[model samples]
Target: MIDILLVPIVLVIILVMLHSYFGMEILKRGIIFTDLAIAQFAALGSSISLGYFHEEHFYLLTLSFALFSAFLIAFASTRKLHLEAFIGILYVLGASGIMMVLSHSAEGMEHFKSLLASDILFTPPMEVAKSAVIYAFIAIALYFIYPKLSGFLKELLFFSLLAITVTSSVSLAGVFVVFVLLIAPPFVALSLNFKKPLLGSFIFGWFFSISAITISYFYDLPTGYSVVFLGAFLTALVVLAASKKALEN
Candidate 1:
C-alpha cells in the first residue's frame, strides 16, 4: 500500500504547490473560470488526438490548443466585451467541441470520462517528472518576468502561464481535478480572509489532496473524483465557517 501510494501522493503535493499560487491569482483577478476554460480546451485537444490521431503527440496538441485559447482570452481581456462572459463562452465551446469529437468513437464515453476525471493512481513517473519541470520553468518565469510586466503584457503572461500549467495538469489530473485544485483550495483560504491567502491555500490543498488520495486508496474509489469530492466538501465547510464568522462580527 505504501509503495502504491507514494508516487501519487508526491505527485499530488507537487501539483498542489504549483496550482495553489495561481489559484490565488485567479481568485483575486475575479476570473474564476479562466482555468476551467483553458483546461477544457486542453481536454478537447486530447479527445481529438484520441479520436482521430491515435494519440500522436497528444501533449503537444493539448498544449497548442490551450495556448491558442489562452492568447484569445488574453486579447479578449483587453476588449470591451464582458471578460467573464467571453470566458464562459470559451468554456462551453470547448466542452461542446469535446462531445462533437467523441460522438462517433467506440471509446468516446470512456475517453470523455478520462478527460474529465483522470485515473491519477496509474499515472506514469515520467509524466510526473515532465510536469514538475514544466511547472518549475513557469515558476521561474513568474518570479523573474511577471513583476516586470505591465498592462496587457502582464495579463497575457499570466494567462499564457496558466495555459501551460493547465495543459500539463489536464493530461494528468483531468479537467475537474484541475479546476478543483485551482479554485477550491484558494477559495477556502480567501473566504477566511487570510492575509497570506496563498500559503493558506497551499496548506488546504495539500491536506485535502492527501486525505482524498488516502481515502480513495483504502476504499478502492477513483482518486481524481475523490479529490474533487473532498475539495468541495472542504470548500463548503470553509465557506460556512466564514459565513458564521461574518454573522458573528
Candidate 2:
C-alpha cells in the first residue's frame, strides 16, 4: 500500500507547494475564480483535441486555450470593467463550449468526469516528475523574473504563468481540484490572519490532501474527488469558524 501511495503523496506535496503560492497571490488579487476560468479554457482545448482529433496535439491545444484565456484576462485587467463578473462569464463560456464539443462523443461523460477530477491514485510517476520540473521553472520565474516586471506586461506574465500551471494541472488532477487547491489553502490561511500565509497554506493543503488520499484508499472512494471534497470541506469549515471568531473579537 505504501508503494501505491508513495507517488501520490509526492505528487500532492509538490502540488501544494506550487499551487499554494498561486492561491495566496490569487486571493490577494481579489480575482478569485481566475484559475477556474483558465482551467476551464484549458479543459475546453483538451475536449476539442479528444473529440475531433483523437487527442492529438493535446498539450499544445490545452496550452493554447489556456494562454488565450490568460491573454483575455490580462487585457481585461487593464480595463475598469467588472473583473470578477467577466471572469465568471469566461468560465461559463469555456464550460459550455466543452459540453458542445464533447456532446457527441461516446466517452463524453467519462471524459467530462475526468476533466472535473481524475483518480490521481493511478497517475504515472513520470507525469508528476515532468510537472515538477515545469513547476520549478515557474517558481524561478515567480522568484526572480516576476518582481522585475511592471504594468501590463507584468499582469500578462502573471496570468500567462498561471495559464501554464493550470494547463498542466487540469490534465494531471482536474478542473475542480485545481480550483480548490488554488483557493482553499490560501483562503483559509488569510482568513485566520496567518503571518506567513504561504507556509500556512502549505500545511493546510498537505493536511487535507493527504488525509483525503488516505481515506480514499481505505474506503475505495475516487481519489481525485476525495481530495476535492476533503480539501474544500475542511477549508470551508476553517474559514467560517475563523470568521465567526473574528466577528466576536
Candidate 3:
C-alpha cells in the first residue's frame, strides 16, 4: 500500500517537471486555455470509451484520445481565425458529454466518479509506469524539437505539451488542480527569471509538490486542492513582489 502511494507521487513529480518545462513555454506564448481544453476533451473521450470498453483498455483509450485531441487543437491553432473560441466551445461540449455519459451508465458512473476525482492514493503501479514512459517520450520530443520550435510551430509544440500534461495530470489529480500544475510553476519561474527557466520551473514544482503533499498528509486535506491553493498563494506573492521590484526599478 505504501509502495502504491509512493509510485503515483513520484510520477506526479515527474509529470509536474515536464508540465513546468512546457508550461513555462506555453505561458510565454499566451495560450493557457489550450491545456484546460485538451484535458477536458481527453476526459470526455475516456468517458465515452468507458461506456463501451472494459477497465483494462481504458488507459490506451485515454492516451489515444489525448494525443488525437492534441493534434486537432494544434492544427486548429494554425488557422487564420483565432482558435480560442473554438477550443472554448470544445471544452464546454466535452464536459457536457462526460456528464451525459456518466448519467447513462451504472458501472460507468463509478468509473466516471473515479475519473472526475482521481484516487491518487490508490493509483495502480501500472498506471504510474505508463505515465512515466509517456512523460519521458514527451521530454525527449521537446528537447530535440525545442531548437527548431520557433514562431507558430513553437506555439504549437508548447500547446501540445500543455495538453498532454494537463490531460495526464487531470487523470491523476483531477481537472481542477491541473490548472495549478500548468500555471503556478511558470508564474514562479517568470517572476524570478532565475537565468534558467527550466531550472526555476523544476524548483518551483518541487516546492509546490512537497508543500502540498505534506499538507495533505498532516491535515487530511484534498491533495489536489491543497496543491492548487498553495501554488496559487505562492504565485500571487511572487507576482506582487516582482511588480513592486519593477516599480522601484
Candidate 4:
C-alpha cells in the first residue's frame, strides 16, 4: 500500500506547490473562472485530437487552444466588459466545441467523460516527471521574470504561463481536478486570513489531497473526484467558519 501510494502522493504535492501561488494571484485579480475556461479549451482541443487519433497525447493541439484562450482573457481583463462574463463565454464555447468534435466518434461520450476526469492512478511515470519539469521551469520564470513585466506584457505573461500549466494539468488530472486545485486551497487560505496565503494554500492543499488519495486507495473511489470533493468540502468549511467568526466579531 505504501509503495502504491508513493507516486500519487508525490504527484499531488508537486501539483499543489506549483498551483497554489498562481491561485493567490488569480484570486487577487478576481478572475476566478479563468483557469476553468483555459482548461476547458485545452480539453476541447484534446477532444478534437481524440476524435482524429483515438488517443489523448495531443499536447501541442491542447496548448494551442489554451494559449488562444489566454490571449482572449488577458485582453479582456483590460477591457470595460465584464471579465467573468467573457470567461464564461469562453468556457461555454469550449464545452460546446468539444461536444461538436466528439459527436460522431464511437466512444464519444466515454471520451468526454474521461476528459472531465481522467484516471490518474494509471498515469505514466515519464509523464509525471515531464510535468514536474515543466512546472519547475514556469516557477523559476515567475520568480525571476514576472516582476519585471508591466501592463499588457504582465497580463500576457501571467496568462500564458497559466495556459501552459492548464494544458498539461487538464490532460493529466482532468478539468475538475485542475479547477479544484487552482481555486480551493487559495480560497480557504484567504478566507482564513493567513499571513502568507500562498504557503497556507500549499499546505492545506497537500493535506487534503493526500488524505483524499489515501481514502480513494482504500475505497476504490475515483482519485480525481475524491480530491475535488475534499478540496471543496474543506474550503467551504473554512469559508463558513470565517463568516461565523466575522459575525460574532
Task: Pick out the ten consecutive residues of candidate 3 with the lowest summed lDDT.
Answer: 113-122
Selected candidate, larger TM-score, 1 vs 4: 1
Candidate 2, which ten residues in sequence have the lowest lDDT sum?
A: 240-249
Comparing 2 and 4 by lDDT, which wins?
2
The 0-to-1 C-alpha lDDT of every candidate, in the order given, reads 0.90, 0.94, 0.72, 0.89
Using TM-score, rank the candidates from best to worst: 2, 1, 4, 3
Select the stronger candidate by lDDT from 1 and 2.
2
Q: What's the true lDDT of residue 43 in model 2? A: 99
RMSD of 2: 1.7
**Per-residue lDDT value at 112 in model 4:** 85
Report the C-alpha lDDT of model 3 over 35-66, residue by residue, as the tens digit. Answer: 77777777876787777664456656766666
Task: Please give the lDDT score at residue 214 for candidate 4.
Answer: 92
RMSD of 4: 2.1
Return the TM-score for each candidate structure.
0.96, 0.97, 0.82, 0.95
lDDT of 4: 0.89
Backbone clashes per model, in order? 0, 0, 0, 0
Global Cα RMSD, each model? 2.1, 1.7, 3.6, 2.1
How many Å off is the CA of 222 in candidate 2?
0.4
Off by over 4 Å in 4: 244-249
Q: Write the per-residue lDDT of candidate 2 for residues 1-249, one digit (tens) a residue.
A: 998999988988999889999988888889999999999999999999999999999999999999999999999999999999999999999999999999999999999999999899988999999999999999999999999999999999999999999998999999988988889999999999999988999999999999999999999999999999999889878888888533563
Q: Which residue runs of candidate 1 sit more than 4 Å off their true CA positions?
A: 244-249
Clashing pairs in 3: none
On lDDT, the candidate that comes out on top is 2
